[model samples]
Structure formats: C-alpha cells, structure tokens
Target: MPNALIIGASRGLGHEFVRQLAGQGWKVFATARNDAALEELRGVGAHACKLDVARPESLAGLGWQLDGESFDLAIYVAGVFGPREGAKSAPTRQDFDLVMHTNVLGAMQALLLVAPMVEAAKGKLVFISSDMASIADASSSYGWIYRSSKAALNMAVRSAASDYPGATFAVLSPGWVRTDMGGENAPLEASESVAGMLDVIAGLKPEESGAYRNYAGKTMPW
Candidate 1:
C-alpha cells in the first residue's frame, strides 16, 4: 500500500483528504490537535497522531514519531484563516501571530522535517495554499493577513524545491470550498475540491515541482 502522511487531519480539507485517501486503501498517517478528532481519524482507518502545528514542540514530537518512515505522499494542511479584515483594518497582534505562525511558520518548519522523508521515497510534497495568495491575480485586500501568510508559504515551498530534488513539491489552491473557513455559501464542496486535488497530485511530474496550481489542475500566477 502507498503510505501517505497528512499534517493536519482534524477538519475541512485536511479531514477530507484523510477520508478519501484512507477509503482508497492508502496507509495513512494523520495528525490532529484534539482527542476527538484523532479518534475520528482512527475510525476512518488512519494512524492518527496528536499534533498542533502552531506548537513547535508538538511538531518536534511528530518528527520523532515519524522517524525513518518514508511516505509516498506527505501533505502540509495545517492552517488558519485569520481576521477577515481589509488593508485598512489592521489585525490585532494576537491574530497576526496566530495566523502567521500556523499558516507560514508551521508549514516552513514541517517542510524541513518532512521533505527528507518524502525524498527517501521519491514522493510528492504538497502544501495547501490559497488562490488569494496570488500576487498577479489580486483583486481585493480582504483577509490581507491571511493572504500574506499564504503568499509567504508559497515562496517558502518554491524555494525549498531546489534543495530536495528527489521529491516533487506542489503548492495547491483548493478554491472557495464550503468548509468552516469558507463558510456555508462557498461554491465548491470539500469532496469535490479534494478529489480534484488528488487528481492533480496524481498527475504531477518532477518537472512541475513548485508549481502553483488550482484543484482543477490549472496553473496559477505567482
């Protein structure tokens, strides 16, 4: 069975990835911050670990726990949508910290730990980014902080790709899916978005490493 690791499997896109991958008979190692979420992942046939991406110590423990394991696929899906404020509305210090730490810093840290494992298996590494992170496509300043964080994440993944040539890296945008973060009226469904992303991942080539694409496989502007 192909081995896969999901960095954040608690809910939304992360949980959806677990469900689909596990149901397809992949040996999935997943992580969540809460006990209940962990249990849910277990119920879905995933080997679940307790992890809070915002906590460096928790991530350190995850690195130790997953030591020596080679994953055919590893995804960094832990992120938070911070204040829904515009450019004029400054985010509070706490919100800024929380958003940046979870979305950018945590991902950067996880990449350092997970990239080698993916390289060992010659696998693919995916970072769940957002279309809002696109600089050329920017139409508004809404969720400025969150957008900035993801943009930083995009750059981080792109820069890291050259160092880990054995593994392919992708930064994907899942679109406006109806999740806790996307709210109820979003056009896409979690299942649809994830399925599309899976297809995109399956078709990824090493030459495409660090490419930013949408769930539907359309390349996006950086």
Candidate 2:
C-alpha cells in the first residue's frame, strides 16, 4: 500500500485528511499535538505521532528518524488561526512570529526535509492553503497574519516545484469548512471540504504545481 503523511491530524480538516487518506488504504503517518484526539486516527488505520509544527527543535527529530524515507504523498496541514489577540491588525510581533513559525517555517522545513524522498519516489507534496491568500479576493484583512502566512506558503510551493522537476506539488484551498478553526458557522463540512480537496489532489501533476486552486478545483486569483 502507498504511504501518506498528514501533519496536524488532531482535529478539524487535518483530522479529516487522516480519515479519508487512511480510508483510501494508505499507510498514514498521522500527527497531532494531543494524544487523546489522535487515538481515533490510529484506530481508523494510521500510525499516531505527536508533532508540534511550531517548534523547530520538535521538528528536528523527525528529520533524523525518517531520514531517506519515501512517502507517496506528504501533506503539510498544521496551522493556527493567527493570534487571537490581533485578528484584525497586522498581528503583534509575538503572534506574527508564532504564526509564521508554525505555518510558513514549518511547511518549508517539512518540504525541504522530504524533498529528496519525494524526488526519489516521484511523489507528491501538498500544502493546505486558503482562499484568504487570494490577493484578488481580499475584501477584509481579518486574518492578516494567517493570510500572509498562506501567501508565503503558496510561494514556497512554487519554490519547491522549481526544485523538483518530476515531483507533483500542489497548493490547495480547502474552502471554509466547519471546524474549530473554521468555527461552527463556516459554510462547509469537514467531509465536504476534504473530499473535494482529495478529488483535486488525486489528479495533481508536475504541470499543475504551484497553481492556486480551491477544493472544487477552480483556480483562485492569486
């Protein structure tokens, strides 16, 4: 069976990625900060791991543990909703650093660590991006920290694409799904968003790398 690794598998859309991928028969390396919340993922057929994407030291161990390991698909899904203190501002230095550390830095580290494996396996690397990254759709600057981080992530995906000529790289926006991060009032369900995302990712190719798209597979203006 193919192997899949999903970061942030504790809850929300990340949890759904673990469920859906495992259901599809992939050997999923599912990670989350909380062990209790992660049990269901292992029960549903995944290898449970605790990964804190925010801490550089925490992530370093994985590099040593999985050195040279190849995964059919690597999905980087760990992220926070910027800092709660400044949801509207440019984000305080602390929150900005936290958001950038977890979302952008963590993603870049993961992609870089796994690049050789992905290149060797001719595999896929997907970054869970957001429609908020769309410069054309920026009606509100509510999530300034989160939005800017995702935009950076989109660019990182492009950089990764350029680094690997044969591997598939994708930047996908999973839509406003109902979850802890998306809140109880969001427009989409976890299943709906994840399934749609899986459909788009299922058909990803090298030519499609660095493209900004929604779960429906429509290109979002960047």
In order of appearance, the predictions have TM-scores of 0.99, 0.93
Error of 1 at 44 (Å): 0.2
Best candidate, lDDT? 1
Off by over 4 Å in 1: none
Candidate 1 matches the true fold with a TM-score of 0.99
lDDT agreement of model 1 with the native = 0.96
Give the Å shift of residue 159 in candidate 1.
0.5
lDDT of 1 at 62: 95
Stretch of 10 with least lDDT, candidate 1: 82-91
Model 1 sits at a Cα RMSD from the real structure of 0.6
Q: Write the per-residue lDDT of candidate 1 for residues 1-222, one digit (tens) a residue.
A: 999999998999999999999999999999999999999999999999999999899999998889889999999999999899899997899999999999999999999999999999999999999999999999999999999999999999999999999999999999999999999999999999999999999999999999999999999999
State each candidate's clash count.
0, 0
Choose the strongest candidate by TM-score.
1
The residue ranges of model 2 lying beyond 4 angstroms of the native Cα positions read: 83-90
